[model samples]
Structure formats: C-alpha cells, structure tokens
Target: MTERPTTTTNAGIPAPSDEFSQSVGPNGPLLLQDHYLIQKMAQFNRERVPERVVHAKGGGAYGVLQITEDVSQFTKAGLFQKGAETDLLLRFSTVAGELGSADSARDPRGFAIKLYTGQGNYDLVGNNTPIFFIRDPQKFSDFIHSQKRRADTHLRDNNMQWDFWTLSPESAHQVTFLMSDRGTPASWRHMNGYGSHTFLWYNADGAKFWVKYHFKTDQGIKNFTGAEADAMKSVDPDHHLRDLRTAIASGDHPAWTLQIQIMPFEDAAEYRFNPFDLTKVWPHGDYPPIDIGKLTLNRNPENYFAEIEQAAFDPANLVPGIGASPDKMLQGRLFSYPDTHRYRIGPNYLQLPVNRPKAPVHSYNKDGPMTYVNSGDPVYAPNSMGGPVADPELWKGESYAVAGEIIRSAYVLHPEDDDYGQPRTLWEKVLSDTDRAHLVANIVGHASAPEVTADMKVRVVEYWRNIAKDLGDHVAKGLAVNGS
Candidate 1:
C-alpha cells in the first residue's frame, strides 16, 4: 500500500488536523486561537488576484517551438536557427469576455505566446486576426469601452458597439471580420494565430528586415456558425475550454506551423500604405510568407492557477536581435503589458516561477512587494563589486533619423493608403459567396437591435458602402432602409 503524504501549512509546518476546527466543545463557539483554521480560511479568501482587464478568461499549455528551417539570414536571434528548440507557454482567450464569460462568444481570440529563449523571455502578444479595428493607441480605451457593458445599465448595448465602429472609419476591416461566423472560433486548436504588428528583425551583419508572424494551425481552421454559437451558450458555456483540455489529455496535441513575411528595410518608405498601420496587412504577393518552424503543445499544466493564470507576457521582453517597430499599437503595448502585470500581479510579478526567465537575470531592478530573490551587495549599477554592465553592441538593431517638431497627427499616407481599400479586397476578393452571405446576416442581426438608433443604422450602411457597394446594398435591403 502507498503512504499518503501529510498536509502542511504554506510555511511547511505539519497541520494538526484539517477536518475540524478547534473549539471549546463540539457545539460551542469556535476558538480564535485556532491558527491552522484561521490560516486556511485567510489564504482561501485571498486565493484569487484581480482578473485581467481585457483577457480575463483564458487557458494555456506548455509546449516546444521547434525550428525546422533556417532563417538565420533575417534574424541573428538564436531561436530562429535551424534545429533550435525553445520551450513556450501559449494562452488562448476571448478579448471582451469577463473571467466567467462563455468561451464561445463572438469575439476576437487573444493568442499570446511567451517563449523562454537562451537570451531571455520573448513575448509575442497578438490576436487571431491579422489586423485590428483601430491603428492608433489613443483610441484603444474608447474602443474597448464600447464593446464592454454600458456604464449605466451594466449590460452590453449593440448601439454603443455600432456607434463606435461606424464613427471610426478605420474600424471597417476588423468590424467586417467580427460580424462574420469566423468571429466565434470552434476551438483554440482549430484557429490560426498572428503577430499582427510589424517588427524589426536584424542579423549579424547589421542588416535589417521588417517581419510579420503567422501561426497556421496544423489541425485546420474551424468555426461555429452564428446559430451554433448561440446554442452553445445554453448547451455548454465552457465548450471551447473543455475541448482543449480533453483533447490534450487524450494525447491529441495541437500544433501550428510558423510562417513569416519579410520586407526589406528600404521598402517601407515607398510602400503603397503606411506599413506600420495595425489596421493594414502586407499583401502576400508583395512579401510572400516563408515557412520557418513548428510549435506543438504537448504538456498540460499541473496547476492551472500557478502555471497559466499567473503567467505574464510582455511585448517589452525583447531579446538582442529582435526589436520593436513604429507600429503605434505595438509601441503602446510595450509599456501597457508590463504596467498591467505590475498592477495586477504586484511589482515582483516577473519573479514568479511561471514568469521567471530561463536565462540568468542580472540587473539593478530590486525591492518590491513579494520580493523573494536576493541580490548580494552592489544593488545599484557602476559599482566596484564588478556587477553586470549594459552592452550597446549586443543590442544592435535598426535605427533611422527623423526631424520635425513633435505634434499630434495621423500617419503620413503613401500613394495607396485609405481606410476602405484593404477591407474592400477582403470582402470582394477574399470571402467566398457563402461567407459574404453569413457576413450580411450577422450584421443585420446585431445592428437591427431595438436599442440601435435608426440614425446609427443609416451610418452603419454608409460604413459598409465604403467597403463595397454590394455589402452596403445587402445591409440596407435586410434592414428595410429606403435611402432614408
């Protein structure tokens, strides 16, 4: 027979008895001197930290990213070398949902990855879609508030959602995607992931290239129809989460093929559109994708709260050869991600076991809440104790000179830059006849809500007309709008 291990307090003291409370008698009042009982209750009360402001509900697994092709010419990052393998943690989430919201909600999924490389932790935070609703970071909060519940009613209002989307012309492309059946992914394993923002990849020779990342699912793309997703809410609110956990436990691990689109550093200056715009995508014909590696999630986390919930992914966690670009959303996130982690998980969140880097951490950052690690003497830099020093050469990346009075303005448009151009291509050239039909139906269902004003409905029609005449006509016909 196997021996059962004894239960202990967090401080490692053997618990006297966990089944009962210390009391004067079986029916008497409980004693305050019951330290073990108080300890258990107090710890349980504080078990949950504040949920994420955006991606509150999520699930993740440990995995290995195996490089199958050589991309050393584009990036000197060690993770890109052929045959190189890096361990990673991937969290799949719905953008608008609360911690307890249904997993099958019609929303864009957050595909955030944290790779533990030799240099340090590299976080690739992105969405399933290749483009976002807005390009500028200044409008991000308003955009999220519109999707979230109303301030007064505390209930989601379709009017607020449409009002924001119709007013912001740049939101056309992402809105078209959200109203389609593709919005409700069937399962995390069946959808594709993208590093939507453009990044700078530099090599050993100081050569620079602009890059975008796409992770195509090996299991194939699958989505639930609008009606099906609605039914799933009543049938099983946790359907997507349950599916992923069950599949992995049954040895049916999921995988994605990593592909990259590389653009020469000089091409952005004359490109048809502002390449840094988060609302735009680089046409495949212009910069074809190069298959680079495979990412397979084979290990399930032993403790969901400790391993997955506590995991922090920051865009600012860049390594030597990889660096940020001028994309406004990406740039804002570089500060926002770490800031949120510090607020949500405390100042020393990085020191948590899950967020800790595989590589040795040597820096001057010290002393905060939950400080566990010790830095022996010379806590500050420029010390005679021979502490670590920053190397400018080790962090060589692309740099360009810009001269102008600092002022607020939109991106300097290239010849082909316009809000509706790419969305037009997406509606006409990309979506099939069936997809177009579903897209229109989904729009009518959401926009025809009683709360949505007639004026807002007319504006919604105008928004689609800019994308394509047929899309506008279909929406108008469905809503019974006779040019009013």
Candidate 2:
C-alpha cells in the first residue's frame, strides 16, 4: 500500500499521532508541550461570536433579485435601472428571542435583505408586518424590555406586556395584529415583508417621492392560530426554519415579488395619517403597489459562520438616487444599525467578504481591528496624490426644501391619529368573518389569564372599544364567560 501523508498542526508542524493527545505518563495531566491539543482547545473555547441582542434566531439564504419592471422615472438607483439584476442575501428571524428560541413564537418576523447592487450594497431592514407598536425611538428599549422576561423573576409576564400596551395607546394597532392569526406565521416563506418605515426616492430630474416597499410572498400568506402555534412549540421548535430549508433542498425555491408604493412629496401636508408613523400604514388603496422585480432564494450558503453569521445590513447603506425620509424611527435606525454592527462585529466589519460592497469603496476610514484592505495612495481626502475624488456633478439625488424650525417635538399626528382607524379598517374590511372570530377569541384568551386582574381586563376592553364597540362587547362577554 502507498504511504499516507500525516496531518500537521496549524503552524505546519508535523504531528506524531492523530488519535491521542500528548499526556504525562499515559492518562495523567495533559502536557503543555502538546501544542496541537492546546491550540484546538483554545480555539474551541473562542468559537462563538456575540449573538445579536434581537433577531438572534434567524434563517438565511443566498438569492438573486431581478428587476422585471422599470421605474426609472421615479428613482435613478442602479438596482432599478432598466433590466438590472443583482445578487442578494435574505434573512428571516423572530424579533424577540435567543438563538435557540422556538421558531414558531408569536412575534414579529424580521424580513431583512442585502442587495449587492452595482453602485453599492442596499439593505432593506423590514418586518413581515406593515406596522409596529411604537412610533418614538425612545420607547424602543422599554418596549423590548416589556416583551422579554421579567429581570427578577426570569419569567415571561403577561402583566408586563399588557401594562406597557395599556399605558401606550400607540401599541393598540400592532397589539391587535399580534393577537390575531398574523402573529404566528406558518412559515417564513409563506409570509409577506414590508419596509415598515417610509423612505424617499429621487429621479434623474431630482424629483422626490416618498416610498414604501412591500415584498409579497409568492407562497401566499399562511398563519397559525394561537392553539396551533402553541402546539407547534411542543411538536417542532424549529418548524419554520426546517420547513424553509427542506423546501429549498427539495427544489422548491421560495420567492417574493417586489412592489413599491410611491407618494408625491407635496401630499405630506394633506395626508390623513402621519406618513412617517411606525405605528400606522398608508392605505394601499391610496398609493397601490407597483411591481418592480422578483426576489428568489435558490442557493444555500456553503458555510453558515463565514456567510450568514458574518452578514451585516444597515438602513444607512443608501446609494445616490435612493435616500431616507423624515421618519423619526427610520432616522434612529440609520444610526443604530451600523453602531450595533460595529460593537457586535468590529470597526472593519464592512471590509468582511460577506458585507463588502461590490462597487469600489473609497473612504477616509482606516487602520482598525482586523484591517483587511490597504489604501494604495492615501486615506485622507483632498489630497494632491492620485486618490479618489468627489464628483459633485454626479451627485444626482433627491432634493427637498425644508422650512420648519429645528425643535425637539413629536411628529404632527394627523387628524386620523386616534389609533383606531386602521385597526377598525382591518377588522371590518381586510379580515374575513372567520378571521374576526379568531381575533376576538385570541384576545379574550390572552386577557383571561389569571395574572390579568379585573381592572386590567376592564381597561383592555375599554381600549378595544375605541377600535370597535362590538369587538369590545364581545371580548368583555368572553372574559365574563371565562369568569374574569
């Protein structure tokens, strides 16, 4: 037989044996001289990176986004240029959970995407739902805390969640959705995605249009009831993730059709709802979705750690022609996302292969931890040496006039800011009779918990009364029937 080559340590030092570790007197204390054993153990100890504080439990896929229809009149972004095509990565996650949390939990599903466009990487950090619970960024930490387990008790408290919701009436709309069937999506592939915050777009003529993105799943919307979701928790903890992977592996590639609703900049003054409110949504009937492209997830990452785990996306990653809106929540996220990535990954995270922009990136930033690239000429701007120069003429982007005083004040909540219009619309118009019945049942079930005092239940009923009198009456009746 031919001789086999022996394995070696990381330093290219040949190993004497492959099966046994170097020990003193055969099974005594481990010898420090065993460099291979030491290296392996040390590396194993440091294998894990920091997990994300939110959206820790996630599933990702490699894909391509192809523009099927052109909207170049509304935006000059290269991704929307005629017949544009780009590589993409999509991640679906639960908003509140540890890495090992159940995939079928009743929480908002994160629908984030990284589009490697020719100009740069564009990230759409969105959610499966069209709206969120709170409008102000300051309330975010407190809201998340309420959703998490109590610090002292280390137990999930229905009281904590309801207490927060009852105090913040802004949460009623999303709370209604969360307590409905939509909260527990059957699978990530079967749900929709929305760029919940309003954004801005500019054309070649510098005309601006407020925009919202919607990704309707080709698989269609399917969700689980409260009982079904609870049962799924016990049956298969990773049901959604496994279902997505298995479907893709079996040649059933999941896809979402990209659509966008555009509103004229002039209409902000006359809109019924605050266009930038994270707690509300623009009626699709007013500004309907225009088909733009299709996003198809056809490939799986070869290495999860190198690709998915290292992937970073930020709302601040906007190119020329694509811009942000005055949405306060969106503004906060522009700073927060990149800041979190720097802390979780490193200052040079953008240079990582998974996050690096496909287009040439030239900036004044340099010399950080894990420095991967070397600027050949100079890192400073306005240099005499041959370096990247700014092109003002090429800066074709949105330009809007601002005439308001710069003051710290809440957004001008429109006449329809009563927090009941959309929820009532959803109940009466969007949902079927069966869905309405399930929604009432779900709300009543949650409110009937022993921890929820009669006063809290009465408050909840009164709150729902603002949305719908019948809904409030039915919920109260259900609570009474359950002997609340």
Candidate 3:
C-alpha cells in the first residue's frame, strides 16, 4: 500500500496520540494542557448547529434545470432562455416536524429549489401543494405554534391543530388536500413540486406577465394509505431520504417536467377570484400549463452537513427579469427567510460553498463572523477610486405604481373570492371516488381523536360543511354528533 497520511488536528498540527486522553496518570484526572484532547472535545461539543424553526428535517441533491423551450417572450431572466442549462440544488422537507421526527407523518412537504445562474442565485421556495391554508403572513407564527408540541404537556396535541383549523375558515382548501392520501407521499420523487405563489415575469421589451411554476414528477404520483404510512414510522422513519439516496446511487435519476401557467398582466385585475390568494389556484382551464424545461437530480451530496444542512434559500433571491407579485405570503418570506438564516447560520451564511453564487459577488456588505472574502479597496460607493456602480436600467423588471392607504385589512375580494369556492371545487370535481373516501376517513380519524373535545368537533363539522354539505355530514356522523 502507498504511505498512509498522518493524522492531524483541525489546524493541521500533527496529533501526538489518536486514542487517549492526556491524564496525570493513565487512570487519573485529565490535564487542561493537553491541547489535542481539549480541541477534540470542544469541536465535538459544537458539531451541531441550531435546527431550523420550520422544515428542520430535510435532504437535498445536486441537479440541473435544462430549458428545452423558449420563454423569452414572457421573461428576460437568463435562466429561462432557450437551451440554457443551469445547475441547481433541491431540498425536500416536512414542514412541521423536528429534525428527529418521522418522515411519514401527515404534513406538507417543502419543495425549495436554489438555481445557480450566471446572474446570481435565485431561490424558489415553495411546497408540494399549489394552494396553502392561509393567504396572509400575519397568522404564520400562530399556525406553526398550533402544529408544534404544546407548552403545557410538551406533546403534539390534535385538539390544538383542529382548533386552529376550525377557527380559521381560510384553511379549508389545504386541509382537504392534507386529509387526502396525497399528504403522505411514498417518496420525494413520486410527488410534484410547485412554486405556489404567482410571480411577476417581465421581458426585455418591458412587457410584464404573471406566472406560476409546476414541477410534475416524471416518476408519476404515488402515495401511501393512512395505515401504510403509520407502519412506515416504525419500519423506517427516514424512508424518504433513504429512497432518494438509493435511487440516485443506483443511477435511477428522478426528473420533473417544468411547466408554467402564464396570464396577461392586465387580466389579473379582472379575474373571477383573487389570483394572488395563496388559498386558491388559477384554474387550469383558463391558463393551461406550457412546458418550459426539465429538472433532473443525478448527484448525491458527498457531505450532508456542508452541502444540504448549510444550504439557505430565500425568495428574495430573484433575478433581474423575474420579480415578486402582490402575494402576501411570498412578500413575508422575502424578509423572514434571510433573517432566519442569519440567526441560525452565521451572518456570513452566503459565503458557504452551497449558498455562494457561481457568479462574482461585489456586495458592499462587509465584516461579520466567518467572512472569508477580502473584497479589498474602495468598499464604499461613489468614491474617487474605481469601484462598482449600479446601472438602474440594465436588465430591470417592470414596476407598478403603489398608491394605497396605509391600513390593516384583508385582500380586497374579487367577484368570486369566497373562502370555500376552490375547496368545494376540489371536493366535487377534482377527487375520484376512492380519493374522496380516503379524504373522509383521514379527517374523521384525526378529528375524532380522544383529545379533541365535543365542542371542537361541532366546529370542525361546521368548517367542513362550509366546504361541502356532504363532507360535513359524514364527519359529523363519524364523530357521533348531530349535524350542526
């Protein structure tokens, strides 16, 4: 064999011993002067970083987004150009569970993507479902608190979850999807991913269009039944992660077709429902999907902690031609995502290899913990020395006038913007007979838990009843309560 490399400490100093603590005697108390032993123990103590507030458990892989069709008429974003192939990272996660929680639990999955382009990094942070429980950001923390363990008993409480869902009428659409078998996806590759928010896309000629992203899995939709998912919790809590790693390793790479629905910028003003509403979707009949590209994951990460765990995605990382819409939840995330990363990771989190953009960074931001970039000379702008300057007109997106009164309010309702309309459509027209049965059974199983009180069950019945008369009737009947 070739000569084996010598073991060393983190600072590259040769370690005196690899398997022993430096004690006064072999069996006596240890000495602080043993720098190697002290360093080893200290590094071990700090090995783990703080877990994320939400989406704590996740796995990701290296991928490429290949643009197969032209969408340049809709947007001038470099990554959207025809035949452009951009490297990307995709992280799949459970929304409410902790780092150690089982992956088979009934919960929404995070489908966050980070695209590395010549311009910069663009993060599309979204979920598996197109629609969400609530449209506004003000109730976000309250929603998470209800899903998390209770303070009183430090246990997950069904009562708290149902109480929040029943009280918030806006939750009907996502709750319907969650109660269906689609919630417990068989694996990350089998389910679809969506950039649920409507985003603004502007062309080089300054024409603006509204767009939504859908990543349809080529592996096909697959899910586990309620009983099957429960069994998976004990059989293999990390089933989803394992499946993805194994599949990629075996050369069975998973791919998704990227389709987008585009609407004329002016049409959103007169749409039947609030198009910006997170609880609703733009009807496929009105705006059919146009195939734009394909995303395929072929590489497993060599180091999970450095590549996946340290990866940070922020919705605010938009390219010049692609910009934010009036969606409230998306607007809220633009601020929250970067802020959380700063606190959880260091202030210089962007300097990490996974999050660092492939393009050169010439930011004025300087001096924080773990900052590796020197960025020497003329850090301040408008200086006598040569420095980077901003060009306001270069690849800029279109801007709209903002002239609204400063007041606290919900979205101004459109002609058909009732809370129950889309959910009612989903129950009546979308789900098949078997899917409907599973949805009903799942809701009844959760709502009829012993922790849930009779009064809450009455409200839960009323909540589902508002979505569909038959659904509420069945849930009420299952809970042995008279129809409210």
Best by TM-score: 3
Question: Worst 10-residue stretch by lDDT in candidate 1?
Answer: 395-404
Per-residue CA lDDT of model 1 for 1-484, tens digit only, reads 9999999988998998979999988989999998999999999999999998898888989899999998888989998899999999999999988989999998999999999999999999988999999998999999999989998999999999999998899998898888887898899999999999999999988899999999999999898988999899899988887888888899999999999999999999899899999999999999999999999998888898998889999999888788899899999999999999999999999899999999998978888789998666788978889898888887776565557778788856698778899989989998889989999999999899889999888998888998998899999999887673
Candidate 3 local lDDT, 330-422, one digit each (tens): 999999999999999999999999999999998778888999995777889888888778877855666976677888887565889888988
The CA lDDT at 60 in model 1 is 87
Clashing residue pairs for model 2: none
TM-score of each: 0.97, 0.94, 0.98
State the local distance difference test value for candidate 2: 0.86
**What is candidate 3's CA lDDT for residue 119?**
91
Report clashes for each candidate as comma-separated counts: 0, 0, 0
Residue clash pairs of candidate 3: none
Most accurate candidate by lDDT? 3
Candidate 3 to truth, TM: 0.98
Put down candidate 2 lDDT per residue, 52-121, tens digits, no spaces.
8778888888889888887988888888876888998998999888888999898999999999988889
lDDT of 1 at 314: 99
> Which stretches of model 2 miss by more than 4 angstroms?
1-19, 411-413, 481-484
